[model samples]
Target: MSQPELSEDELLQRAGRGDARAFDQLYDRLAPRLFGLLRQMLYDEKEAEEVLQEGFVQLWERAPSFDPERSKAFTWAVMLFRHKAIDRMRMLGRRNRLVDGAVLEQTTLGGSSQAADEALQDAERGEAVRQALNELPKEQRQLIECAFLKGLTHHVIAESFGMPLGTVKTNIRRGLLRLRDLLKGGA
Candidate 1:
């Protein structure tokens, strides 16, 4: 009889133990699905491809810490990829913000009073967002700040705060939902 194929969890476990063949098999099995996910998250083929490659490198380094009792290999891999994608998004956002600030400064210098008025409006909107975030419960607010403003991954936030992963995710989600509602109502 032919031998059965190894399960993803089993393959991951073997990879954790430094089995090169098992790692290759795991990559073959998971890369396509992960690439699809990255494409959807990044909305740019090149960025997705880069993240997929980086995420696999990270996965290899971290796999020895994978705990099957805590979660499946695929779920663990998904989290790693998602974190990488989010980091990429955050980096892009920061770059865009810097470019926008420069543009705003140049416009204010060259344009009429209308540009100044727009900048003032932007400041007011920022204050409103700050106030809205302040209205959240402390736990939710802290988690949100850590994840977004600090650009920390969910796993890092959970570990640093000594909270369960589920709790961290839940708080961030609920906080964002409440912040959205507050913004909409304010607007």
Candidate 2:
């Protein structure tokens, strides 16, 4: 006799790309098996609930990266859910490693934009630059703000702010120096 075949991965992939029906199919395919496995592994109902739900959420979030070549869909979810539950077991040591590895991977993939919408979604890259304005001192930021936002003449700003034009110039230069450091630190 032959076992029936299932398109578990195709459904999960569609779900990962935001199809509601695919998500439902994935839930139908995996939820019962997961609940059973968790029941055998965990004694406390609350612990099982937390671990199972967390595992499910990670499945949804990271589903886009799941590769059928690596493992069967059911086995992958089971392994992930088990590791998630077990992580709560003794996390102090291994938690840091897991977080660090994830951070490293995200760093490498940070610049990948699948669409123009995704790239423009930040739309506030300017505000991000403004926040990084920590690169400049208050005086410099004020000067740049006055010069750029108000369209004030540099000489006029120097006179209104009670400073010589050259000092204003000096602050703008040094402030830009600090901002470079701030943005680098963020990355």
CA lDDT, every prediction?
0.85, 0.70
Q: What TM-score would every model get versus the actual structure?
A: 0.59, 0.44
Best by lDDT: 1
Best by TM-score: 1
| lDDT digits (tens) for residues 1-187 of candidate 1 | 9989999999999999999899999999999999999999989777788789999999999989999999999999999999999998996566446445655665677667666677777656665566677577767977987887678999999999999999999999999999998888843
Which stretches of candidate 2 lie above 4 Å from their native place?
Answer: 1-6, 91-187
lDDT by residue for model 2 (86-183), tens: 77665423433443444445444666644555444443444445556523555787786677545788899999999999998888777777767776
> Model 1, stretches more than 4 Å misplaced?
111-187
